[model samples]
Target: MSIHLFNKRTALMLTLAATLTACGSDNDDNMTEPPPPQPEPMEYSYDITVVNLTHEQPLSPITAVLHADGKMWDIGMSSSIALEKLAEGGDNTDFISQESVIANASAQGPLMPGLSETLTITTTDELATHLTMVSMLVNTNDAFSGLTNLELSTLDVDATMSWHLAVYDAGTEANTEAMGTIPGPADGGTGYSMIRDDVDRVSMHSGVVSQDDGLMSSVLTQAHRFDNPSIKLTITRTK
Candidate 1:
């Protein structure tokens, strides 16, 4: 081939290679790594502490729940089977599993008098703005202590709230304090009975009427008696 023809062909080949390289560079520059994966939703967490304040009454395993705006129980209303179970028997399985609950944490065991326990619950549900806690005074027939439908939306992270809880009666059973009716160690007897013998509604507890109080049929004694504000509860938002 002639030198002039060969040189012109070489220059054309180099120009084409340069153009392809430039196009590749432009494509790379226009390309973007997919946006950093969006972060997961933030988690909200809370810690609950419960202290048993009675002299002889043992608080049942606590059922701490975070729920929507509804309550688990209302005074003057009929007690739910779940509440009845917790109050009369110190069993919280049904109470924590209620439909309104968004998140829940249960104490590992009963809180004895003068003792305390702490449980932690976490959730991402923004609708879980209310808190409910329930535990029984096991020495009585149907006595319980708790606070229900407490608003927690305004409780900031690291903030704390507390309450001295009063006792309530499930009223599902008569306060007989009989040999086979008291559920605690004082009797080790029956816990729950489907029979609604007493007032079926909830109300403030009138405290236990022990044998020392002249109830001759009662198994409970002076030590088994209790007063209002039988429990102290504190809640802290961790996140």
Candidate 2:
């Protein structure tokens, strides 16, 4: 009877030990930790600065866009209605809202003659590889200046690229420069007339023939006339 009692106690001790070991193994599995967190994707950014190089023509609110494809304006092609709206009235709302635009920005107000404006644009999207900028010459009829479809992919971060921009005629309106046709403070005239009365094509602008030069009907004087390279643009990749 004593030996049987001793054997029963031994069996109970072994079973308890096995059960405790199994429970410990299960607890270790449950206590395992998760992996570490991941870092966020890097953002691509740029700083764009525009300096009005003209003597008198105040630049309209500048419109800057980062896009993948398509152009804001072409030398030979007819200007889009959106472009016309901008070149004619200094309104950039439709130009920057186009479908091809990935990211866009605009200056708060007109950049005065000999003044400068800076704008920053950023995106995580790798597809936004092209840049375009447009702004009208408020003192001229349908005259605009800026870059179009400029490639940004090759530009390295922290590097800068700059160019002197020439004026371009939207050709959507005649360069009459009449009393009520010019917009700026010079005339306080009508901004946009959708008559399509010009050459109907885009071309490099012929410097204004202000009244000081001839064009007796022109509301502008010699101070309002500008030559090639009307604006200076500098672009820097920040990230």
Instruction: Report the error of model 1 at residue 61, Å.
Output: 0.5
- Put down candidate 2 lDDT per residue, 1-239, tens digits, no spaces: 99999999999999987887688778796643435577787788889999999999999998899998777778888999899989988989888898898999888999998899899988888789899988999999899999998898889999999999999999999999999987888899988888899888999998799998889999999999899898899999999
Name the top TM-score candidate: 1
> Evaluated with lDDT, which candidate comes out highest?
1
TM-score of each: 0.84, 0.83
- In angstroms, how far off is 96's CA in candidate 2? 0.9
Error of 2 at 44 (Å): 1.2
- Candidate 2 global CA lDDT score: 0.90
Report the lDDT of model 1 for residue 118.
Answer: 91
Cα-based lDDT for every prediction: 0.90, 0.90
Looking at model 2, residue 32 earns an lDDT score of: 35
Per-residue lDDT for 202 in model 2? 97
Tell me the spans in candidate 1 whose CA falls farther than 4 Å from its real position.
Answer: 1-36
